[model samples]
Target: MAALRDAVGRYGIWSAELHTVSPGERGEAAARLEALGYGAVWFGGSPGVEDAAPLVEGATGITVATGILSIWQHTPAEAGARFLELEAAHPGRFLLGIGASHAKLAAQYERPYSAMVEYLDGLDAAGVPASRVVLAALGPKMLRLSRDRAGGAHPYLVTPEHTAEARGILGEAPLLAPDLKVVLETDPGLARSAAREHFARYLELPNYTNNFLRIGFTEDDIAGGGSDRLVDAVYAWGDDARVRDRIDAFLAAGADHVALQIVRGGTPTGLPADEWRRLAAVLGL
Candidate 1:
């Protein structure tokens, strides 16, 4: 827990990438990113915790994490093996971010929380140290479970406010790391356009929609992409200083680490290499 806490204190700027760098180039990209000073990389999209190793190899020492791996789609044995392998390769630089994926979407979502607990129990029984992992939590129920069962929660698609709420729920100890979306372009309308278009898919997912509604977004705000207010709040855009300011907002609100996702293309929020370099420069890491 102390190591996890130390990680949070040190990993001030983490970069999030939905599209993984191809194997041929991933390692190189990661090395460059590490050389650039980004402390960690948050990866997503269903490869389970197994994805950590290859990407970790990409960067010499930067921490590589699954933004989340649905606990339903894989077993603890497999994840445990991969977890150990990566840990052997990089030690403290690999963090496994796991989740009880939404019941509406996961292949096996029965007793979601309980299933996750069971999964964790198996991991423990199989010898996967709990400190090496985190839960993708949002609401209080999961947040509390995250505190008790594993290291902490890695909440996605949330604002600084949610980080504050999660911090309160998890209390003073569990790590509270939240991901924030960003569009580096100076154009508000364009950045919001990219954000809204990219966010429409998640809006239909009841869990995220429900969370947004609870967070004060109107039905209109959730409809047809997203309202300007919703887009601006969720996606930190404008200048380097502005985005850094938003990161500060999350930190002040109690987030230990903020994963910054750069939205480059409208279709998949592509993060161009040059763009990543630019951000890395401004972040001073």
Candidate 2:
């Protein structure tokens, strides 16, 4: 956890569209994030580790992690090779975050727990140290595996309360970094609307909903694009102060680091540089 926290500081960016941005633009943004004192930049959209190499090269110090590279998409041997290549080039600047992903999203999804174990075994045989990898876990079994095998857990679309519960499961040592969605809007309606827009897709996925249910949300709370209460609980919205409070809450709840997925205005595309800059000032990062 110490190494994971050092690699990714108190806060970092989690943007799925980061890899889709133009190479020059991505490089500039990566460098800017490093300059802004962000500890890491999480590449999402189920990226292959190779996809993140350019961004890792663009930034000199900041850690570059795959928010999650789907296990179904890349075999452990392939992922291990990529990890070695990147580590050789950048040393400790990369973290390979892997997950079983959602059953609905992967055709080959089956016995996720066993599959992850097998994948880790492959990685182990290929010489990828456990310290260099993290798991995208949401439940007790997976979280336990995260503690026993990997460096820690990186749960997505979760709240501070969930962070606390996860901390209990992970104990005090494993890295407990969760992806938090944020909306930088002052108006309640606008903020919730933005949150709902971004959250609607996840609502259809049972993996996320089951996790939400495990954390106490009812089926109704998961219905109709999520309730206002659900939206508020899941997303940190409003001004910088409001967002800061939410970030602080997660840290207080025992999260080692918070990977913020900034939802500026309503769109979740391109680089939200201005929002990131504002958040940096607010967080004093």
Q: Could you say which candidate leads in TM-score?
A: 2
In model 1, the worst 10-residue window by lDDT is 9-18
lDDT of 1 by residue, 1-285 (tens): 777766544343344453545654656666776777776777766566655566677666677778787887788988888788878877788888898767677866687778888889988987888877899998888899889988888888998888888999988888788888878878877887778777877887888888888877789888778888888878888898998788788989988777777776554533467877887777776
Encode model 2's per-residue lDDT on 1-285: one tens digit a residue. Answer: 687788789899998878668767776788999999899899988999988888898989999999899999999999999999999999999999999998889988899999999999999999999987899999999999999999999999988889999999999888888999888889999888888888888998898999999999999999999998889888999888898998899999999999988885554567888888988998997
TM-score of model 1 (CA atoms): 0.92
The regions of model 2 sitting more than 4 angstroms off are 265-269
RMSD of 2: 1.1
Structural similarity to truth (TM-score) of each candidate: 0.92, 0.97
State the lDDT at 93 in candidate 1.
Answer: 83
Angstrom error at residue 42, model 1: 1.1
| Candidate 2 Cα deviation (angstroms), residue 196 | 0.4
Model 1: which residue pairs collide?
Answer: 27-58, 36-285, 37-285
Q: Report the Cα lDDT for candidate 2.
A: 0.89
Residue 156 of model 1, lDDT score: 85
